[model samples]
Target: MTIGKGLLFSLLISLVVQGCHSVVFKQSFDKQKWNDKEDWDYPQRNNVVDDLVKNHRLKGLNYKQLINLLGIPQGQSEDSAGIYYQIVMDFGNDIDPVYTKNLLIGFNKDSIVNSITINEWKKP
Candidate 1:
């Protein structure tokens, strides 16, 4: 291959690979940012979700501590499995919600956190 043509091919291949996956920056968990609403901001929970769920970080925290860290949850998970913090809600163009994502925190009988998961629900 000619030098110029080889360079072009490599650039094309790099661009294609980069385009295949979306880049999501994982932010450090910030309690204040998680609840800041005055500036019309959201998605803070979604950003820090990776940090919270990684390494079973929330496993030993009690319900009260969880509340202290995350504030009051948006609501309990369906089937009463766990409490959840609303991470993101996508409405798109239509009025009804098209998808919803939440941080579901499950607890044991002693009210200590047992599981933490990112629950994503999408409309059919």
Candidate 2:
């Protein structure tokens, strides 16, 4: 190839490598955020039980309302009466990150939360 063409090809290759590196870096960061045990935000000692007991007012609360108060849930299950949301607040074990399951229970009927419970926040 001509000198000019070779230079252009080289530049293109460099750009491709740089792009790939950036994408890989971004993916690694996202994975770390998702899986890092340290990212779990456990409730403070004084407030832990209190926070769990302050259930969503069944008459006045809904799913979105609960989410607004508590943040996104880790998982959810549903049936005719309502949707049950499992809100994981934090990791129970630093060494075994998967051993803990923080549950923020939300019961929603037709998108409105009829009730909520902090059913379980324990290591399993």
Judging by lDDT against the true structure, name the best candidate.
1
Q: Using TM-score as the measure, which candidate wins?
A: 1
Misplaced by over 4 Å in model 1 are 1-22, 38-41
lDDT for 41 (candidate 1): 31
TM-score of model 2 relative to the true fold?
0.39
Clashes of each: 0, 1
lDDT of 2 by residue, 1-124 (tens): 6999999999999999889864422121121233334334532322333434453244456667756655555565444454443324444446654433334454544666555544554555
Q: Model 2 lDDT vs. the true structure? A: 0.47
Please give the TM-score that candidate 1 achieves against the real structure: 0.74
- TM-scores for all predictions: 0.74, 0.39
Instruction: Mark the 10 consecutive residues where model 2 has the least summed lDDT.
Output: 24-33
